[model samples]
Target: MSSPASGHPSPPRRGPRIAAISATIALFVAMIGIATSTQASAAPGCKVDYSTSNWGGGGFTGSVKITNVGDAITGGWTLRFAFPGSQTISQGWSATWAQSGTGVTATSMSWNGNLGAGASVDIGFNGTYSGTNASPTSFSLNNVTCTGQPGTTTTTTTTTTTTTPGGPGPGNRVDNPYVGAKVYVNPDWSAKAAAESGGSRISNQPTAVWLDRIAAINGTTSARGLVAHLDEAVRQAAGSTLTIQLVIYNLPGRDCSALASNGELGATEIDRYKTEYIDPIAAILGRSAYANLRIVTVVEIDSLPNLITNVSPRPTSTPNCDVMKANGNYVTGVGYALAKLGAVANVYNYIDIGHHGWLGWDDNFGPTAELLYTAANASGSTKANVHGFIANTANYGATTEPYFKVGDTVGGQPIREKAKWIDYNKYVDELSYAQAFRQRAVQAGFDSGVGMLIDTSRNGWGGTARPTGPGPTTSPDAYVDGGRIDRRIHLGNWCNQKGAGLGARPTAAPASGIDAYVWVKPPGESDGASKEIPNEEGKGFDRMCDPTYTGNARNGNSMSGALPDAPLSGAWFSAQFQELMKNAYPAL
Candidate 1:
């Protein structure tokens, strides 16, 4: 949901890295002692190092490193263990997991089947527990017991303290990068914002740097290249911990469902995307010079969601979308990006999931989770590669609809059922959708510790026209239309919305399951040109960006609600900037 569609020439970079650094220090690593039991006789020998990050609420993520101390199990091997308490495995990765009663078995995958002597493989799982969550005292590799150091048993407890913000600390991979850290302000965005009237209020905020095209990797005439941004981030850090956000867009045949923001790469040009796009970015990110910074990469917005909602068999299907789905390029490209970027220790990958309005229905919700899971495990990637997800990027879904709930009734019917705008969708805003999606993601095999981010750059629907109270209950449509904070003519209208405002200021840990509320979309950037003004950026004019756009099936045949006289996507629009400031929810 970014501006400049295909070639995202640097937008306003508005999202500040508002990460919440927890005052309460988290116990990162807990190591337990194991006593060898008779079960050890079944196999040669092994050592398993198990650790977990407990987020409380009965959820925890476990990381296990299995080292074969004895003979190599050539063909395949199954690591078995039992929970000492009421723990239940909900999702796992790096190996195939199955549980029965208290016993659990993890079989090696095809790629990691053979184990040479002294070799080790790391695997993990997300689990829930009741009562007490205790670590397993023993594990068996290939049915043989894992006995360490001939009866010399000991336990290790490691505590990490938040160091003064600077380069990488002892625990480089903090549970939440935004926590206990300062966000890097993109000077490029700051300079532009400072030039706007009253834009200085947010000029210093951290916004994401979008590498929307191959040329964006290097410096475009209009924008700084990836290396330049990283170098600047290092300088910004000085000697403190800082977080930088980057949007890794540009999948082959990108934005297949929409004409605007169409990318340069062809459907079959997967190799070029890998080598030319992702590889260069990954290389720059992996450099030790910038190792101390926390880099958050928002992987491909508008790619996967289209596969479910706009492909063949759906009335809204597009021929280009069908081709993208058939070739599996979107899936392959996202997986490839996740693998490459995630390989960098400091990089955290948050895949983009379209707003609630786009996938809040029963059919779209579960399928989207499954599809995301597939992508996380595709292209030599694993669930471990994903850090979390971001929602409502470059869209106008409110952070919350305060006046009423979806379950509220009007005329004896659920508001969702009665309201023309909601149209039976479960969620009415981005925050609710993001939290719910996190649960679905964990159930779909992602880490339970995964957090969520919401792009609040332009969804704040505050202004004189803002609703003060719940709409009248005379009927569903009136109730929803009157009080709903999201003032878009239709839930599907996502371009430069007419009455949009700056949403919540970027902040850390604003809500449960949310890591931060970011300005990933860079408010004030045109979503797409209101009318076709051809250029070299690969952006096409879509009617959805037109002020008088009649309707589209995707938007329930409603008005586009976009502002008029907008420039190409990603190009700065001073008029939109003034509007965002004037209408900011928290008030500038």
Candidate 2:
């Protein structure tokens, strides 16, 4: 709920750009051999399983599975091997990859760094090779030999080619994991929705599972744990590709700008976040059972933006924000999470970039993009770890303003200047903001293939009060206010907004550079409690959720537009649910 602001209307949307599709002819070859570990105290034994697929034109994809057969690898592990041919790695996943001449080094990611005796991990890369694509004959773990022994040998090779358009080949990550994949439907939220008066209509829709605390990784008395949800997702997949959305929300000193969603960890508890929180989640996700499912993680909502917009020296700075920025725990925790979770072959990480209202302005936009690049490149993570980003998560910004343009002029003046609500922000809606942000993100050094997602859960703003046409040209304010789709008291007013309605349903590849329109925030969950009702979940009361509270620097001292009688954040508010359904845009 606490995010920054932007000014100036955005430029017009650009035409769809040409996208490249790679055709890969995969050749699956399996080989098994013993890898002797000299560093192990007891019997230093290990095994390596090597497999590869060739993409014509000298391109290939390889998969390596390492199992520790002897003593436990406590601290970390490093795998060193040499390619028999003149093979060179172009891109790698599930680990850090490097090559020196014919020699290759694959280091453990933070999540899979530790392996107990008999435990195994999967890692691979996309490479180029000449001559026969023969598998590596020898491998080493922690500087010990893993292959080329006279053990029982099993080798099999199979070749097949299938082009999925924007998808990666077998054992490789797809460009858009959502395309052609059925998303996991959470039974918990589905039950809640189906139980409501008109909830059955949208109950089956997929929403993100919020693992906001450590307890969520296992189970809470009232909710299923991460493993249970993943297992359910696997069952629902029915042997086909399915995407399970998870919100990685438990960073230390989280939501520093707002108290309602504060996490349990302390400001300096980066270690706990890594070991207790992220590590367990990663372990569960990396399990081979769920490898077939596409895992999309919305990492650490509202964390990084707070560092840029809510830290000291800014007008909206808070003490908690300052502490988080100075300690650098937010950066460390996010980076660590990205690196650990990213090591999973099927997992696709999408960092949260607060809404257009928060970072659509010039000052906040570029700096926040730079900060995202910084975090993505920190804590053993490379930019490749971040698949893409999501915008307007759990916030009420309209998806698109079809009527008035930011460049519109009224009475010989720009609408942004006269429109009180426009606030001189560069973006007027989520779609424009998301597409523009994608370009900037790529310019900031993220992969050009990165996509954008917009949260269209509660920003419909379409009821009887919905604007029908462009506003009058008498004054800028009249024209802008009359034509705007969002009816919040102010762009900063986020909570149980009274006139809010459900926006677009989830859809993949809805627009250029856009991945999907998702309901990241479930329709009925209250943003925060309307009054001071205490609980043990570390959730606190925030005035923004109160209907009577007025005036804050962030909201320009405007009255809090939240509805009355709302429950604590994440609790089911039946009244709100009915209202959302009644006001459903594109009508339920």
Model 1 clash count equals 19
Alpha carbon lDDT of residue 147, candidate 2? 41
lDDT of each: 0.77, 0.77
TM-score of 1: 0.74
lDDT of 2 by residue, 1-588 (tens): 111111111222222121112232222212222233332133455667787755447776677777666555554566888988899997665566889999999866433555676777777676888887777777776555544332333331212112233321124787778889998888888999999987999999998898988888888877899999999998999988899999988888888888777778989999999999999999999898888899999999889988878877877888998999999998898899989888887888998888887788768877888999999988988888888999999888999999886656676666655567776676799987887677678668887667788888888887898999988888988887888889888888887888889999899868656778888887888888899898888888888889999948777788888889988888888888888888778788
The true-versus-predicted C-alpha distance at residue 7 of model 1, in Å, is 18
Deviating ranges (above 4 Å) for candidate 1: 1-172
Runs in model 2 deviating more than 4 A are: 1-171
Could you give the C-alpha RMSD of every candidate to the true structure, in order shown?
13.0, 16.5
| Candidate 2: Cα lDDT at 468 | 95
